[model samples]
Target chain A: MKNFVWLLAVSVSLSGCQHPSLAYITNQGDSTVSVIDAAQQTVTHTITVGKAPVGVAVSKELQRIYISNVEGQSISVIDSQTLAVTETLSIQGSPVGVALSPNSQTLYVADWYSDRILAIDTSNTKIQREVIVDKAPAGLVVSPDNKTLYVAARDSNQIVAIDTQSLTIQKRIDVGVHPFGVSLSADGKHLYSVNVYDNSISMIDLKDVEAKTHSIKVGEHPYCAMPNSDNTKLYVSNTQDDTVSVIDLNTRKLISTIKVGMTPEGLDYDARNHQVLVANWGTNDVSVIDARTDKVISTIKTGNQSRAFGQFVMQ
Target chain B: MKKLLTIIALAALSFNAAAHGPSPQKVEKTIVIKAAPAKVWAVVKDFGNMHAWHPAIASTKLEKKGDETFRTLTLKDGGTIYEKLRTADDADMKLRYEIVDGVAPVADYNAFMQVTAGPGAGESTVTWVGRFYRTYKLNPPIPAGQDDETAVKFVTGVYDSGLANMKKVIENSK
Candidate 1:
């Protein structure tokens, strides 16, 4: 019995080593996705997709990575382990932002030009339903409980929440102008929207709907945001300013601002590696920020025009 | 809100509509000028007097509204370009600007000019960088004058001529 327990522990750690964290950086200019292994700090594969790949949704359980090709009007599904494009789903409109449900059964795609949200069945690759929301639907995030999917309506200046099960609009929460990137806390207790034009972040309380939403001022022309695992802080990438604003969530104050590459766009928190991977659109590089120190430790050059819009890290 | 709708509708229907592109473009050009860092920066920092150095500009008009400063440049090619001054840091010898609206075949154009000490004595390197998107953003069959190549070529030409003339003007002076 004692030997069996020791063997089980060894096997568990072996599985963990086999599956290192990976970051999928969608390069829009080159129309390819750079799959980087976090442990090695290098790209393992460069999978070519359709034209203008902008968004990424990684599913660890399903072992798949879905990439939205805005100009190609399709989604390229890549096998996470094999690093190969297995299938391509033809979308009707231009797909920009993409998200996966907690259960990984439904993939939500925000069509930027069509102003609609598409719920594609994961197992079959068929779009189960689509609903027209506003002028432009850009960012999307599903709740931890898999009950709600929030989308940022860019031109309408609102965050629209839709019921995942019923596939219906629940609430149109007004946010700052040009809210382009939307994210939810790990615990699903708060929602943050990055207003590109307003240069601010809106934090909405999910536990208490009656609570007043708080708006935190950030740098110029903020693009995307990501929250730490503990929900104690938030990081926003300021595109125009070429910096990242670190916000202390408890006090709702700016903690620090770190300068990065020009036109930093997509950002994702790597919990396993305790790092933040930022895609620099202008410099075509990935700036890796150490979450503990809030400093850029290294920068890995990627394809031309890297904009990993959605959650790209798979732990 | 209604005005925003009107703007969108007009942009969609206009023949040479200025829509956004899927991929962003960048152009960075550098020239080693035989001058001090501060001296070269003085020419770049004089945002209102670009026509003095750049041959493509016929004249420049500077206006200030509240805390914001704007400049209108009348091109020698019989066109005009409006731009806003973002920042001018004397310490770093860097100036940042953005195009408000112009005949340039680009949208959301943001640029910066920086002067740094060069590899040789009594010399400074000037770097001009521009980031923007093509005016026509839709998928295929882009307009002749609004595609990515056209936009990049136009901006490249502008930078080449302006930098060459600025070099000649600065080097020949004194």
Candidate 2:
């Protein structure tokens, strides 16, 4: 009977260890990145990164996290297990947004001031190509198909789509004033843009560039948009209004709005826990929401002002 | 002929002493007056008459405390910007003033305007130089973070526009 109890105990322990969700949130106000224990819903550790780290991208396959420093002009690489900066990759003028390829082998950096997109090889940490884009490219995304990259040009009021293979601009579609953040659907058929000045999200049909799609009204200043794991819901961080607007993809309408800290800017979803992590720039905190209910489950304290989050694989 | 030359030399010396004088800073905006320098100087020296020249400033009031010092209030955007003129030299064709605290929406700024004689080879040159710094508060803290260059751009644009307008006013003058 004792032997049977031991086996049952061992099985329970192993099942508990099966799910370990971790995330690294970059806070620009405090110049640090908070290492979060997603399962525990708390900040396990904080790592010091470059000055004003604003953008972060995780390569799950490589078990690395890349944080973009707006003032430092470099990317800090953090090891998932250690939660320490393992390497610093130098980039061009004021790197605002960063993304990893679907294959997790390449990194794309959008330089806001220099008006260029830098493609860096993750293994060598060397720039493979630097493609010039429209004026003030602030937000970037790689299509789910991994064949094209979309960049939002703030000053030009347009989105520049580039062919990933040729590193050439494929098309320039007119967005709204101060187009800052962009995202693509899982099927790679639709593109969503957060127009800062217009305070709305522009849904574009990639197949039909001239299609008159819907413009959903959002907060006072919609800065960035993130799609759910299932690609069914869209979460937008409204900077000026200090709220996050949850949109239902099927209805193409705002389902709910949740109030956050001073200025909520960056957003991403945790597939394992079904929670959304929001980086609030003004208050320097991250709000974790239960995706099942669309309600904030807990508030995790990060750097002085945590701005963005990325995943890091456990080696 | 020598006596006539001596009289002319004396007259020129007196004219030179009358034209040139000393001052701290010069304030000169070249607005085509269709009027003479003395007439324009009459309009420029009295800070109260600035509303007629500067388009951005709706009105101004000059209250003199002493022979050389005066308090000037410029009204714009439903508010008043106060400045103190430390020195006003009509002979030197100069007006010197310093912005008072809480004078404008711009929190940190110090400006000076000078009006000297224009280029005539030997003529004086009216030079205007302003130096000030502006600070910005990120309403929603930057997610990818605060770029100091971004703040610098915001302030630089304001100063640049003001300088451009001042230049336009002076250049369009007759």
RMSD of each: 5.2, 18.5
Please give each candidate's TM-score: 0.91, 0.63
Candidate 2 chain A weakest lDDT stretch, 10 residues: A306-315
lDDT of 2 by residue, A1-315 (tens): 999999999997786568477777887656788878887978888889987787878875677889898767789998876777899987656777788888987799887667889998888876578899977777788887789989898778889999999899989998877788888777888888899878899888898878766789898668788778788899899875669999998899999999887567778777788888888765668888888898888988777766683323221
Interface RMSD of each: 3.1, 19.7
- Candidate fnat values, all: 0.18, 0.00
Model 1 chain A worst lDDT run, 10 consecutive residues: A204-213
How close to the true structure is residue A162 of candidate 1, measured as C-alpha lDDT? 93
Model 2: lDDT equals 0.67
Query: Tens digit of lDDT per residue, candidate 2, span B100-168?
Result: 543232222333334454444322333333322222222223322122333233234333443455445
Error of 2 at B158 (Å): 18
Q: How close is candidate 1 to the true structure, as a TM-score?
A: 0.91
lDDT of 1 by residue, A1-315 (tens): 999999999997899667889999999889999988876789888999988899999998899999999878899999987888999999877789999998999999988767789999999976578888886789999999999999999888999999988888999898998898999999898999999878999999976655768999999889899999998889999998889999999999999999999889999999988899999998989999999999999889999889999999999
- Model 2 lDDT, residue B45, Cα: 61
